[model samples]
Target: MGSRRRTPYGPGNPGASLTVHPLEGCRGIRAAGEVGLATHTIWEGVLEQAVREGEDVYYLELSEVTFVDVAGAGALAAAAGRLGAGRRLVVRRPPPALRRTLEAFWPGLPAIEVTM
Candidate 1:
């Protein structure tokens, strides 16, 4: 798997970084680091790529991710919304707050499935 890294600085947070790695045996990505305003572009880009891949199920393995803001979670939900019927985004081991944010704002959304 190839690894790509991005570091975007935001106010009061200079150490912000996000790394995305292609999964070895699946059509998905595993991400690490923080997802905030500064790193959202990369986050959105990955999500868009997943959507364009047109797979029945796309995986986002985020167990190593440390933080995800509301907007980041919103971006994920939006990406899932773009999928065609019977397709879904499978989020694995995402941060608890990210899952809460998804449930709080986009309750019962069918296109996104979260697994701990």
Candidate 2:
């Protein structure tokens, strides 16, 4: 297992960081912390990397994710849309905020599947 990287968000609060770590026994990663303007880029990069790595199915465990802003939600939606044929982006146990954000902003997105 790899170590967790702390990615700081926003300009002023350098102390506030997001923890991103690789998921064990799966072709994906888990993110814990706030997903905002400063941290959304990290999410996009991770998503693209997962796609590039040829993972037929990508998983993102967002149960520990504290918050999701508009840009963060967009990033997730875009990542889901980028999957190729027979590929999927499974979101496992997403937090209520993330679920509600997806439901309110992007209803009926075929690529993103939410499981309990």
RMSD of each: 2.0, 2.9
Native-referenced Cα lDDT, model 2: 0.75
* Model 2, runs deviating above 4 Å: 1-14
Error of 2 at 48 (Å): 1.2
Taking the tens digit of each residue's C-alpha lDDT, what string does model 1 give over 8-116? 4653257787889898898999998888867887888899999999999999999998899888898999999999999999999999989999989999999999999
Model 1 RMSD in angstroms: 2.0
Flag regions of model 1 displaced more than 4 Å. Answer: 1-8, 11-13
Worst 10 residues of 1 by lDDT: 3-12
**How well is each residue in 1-116 modelled by candidate 2, as lDDT tens digits?**
22233445463245444577888898888887766666666777777876777777888888887677777778888887787777778888887877888999889888888888
The clash tally of candidate 1 reads 0
Indicate the TM-score of model 1.
Answer: 0.91
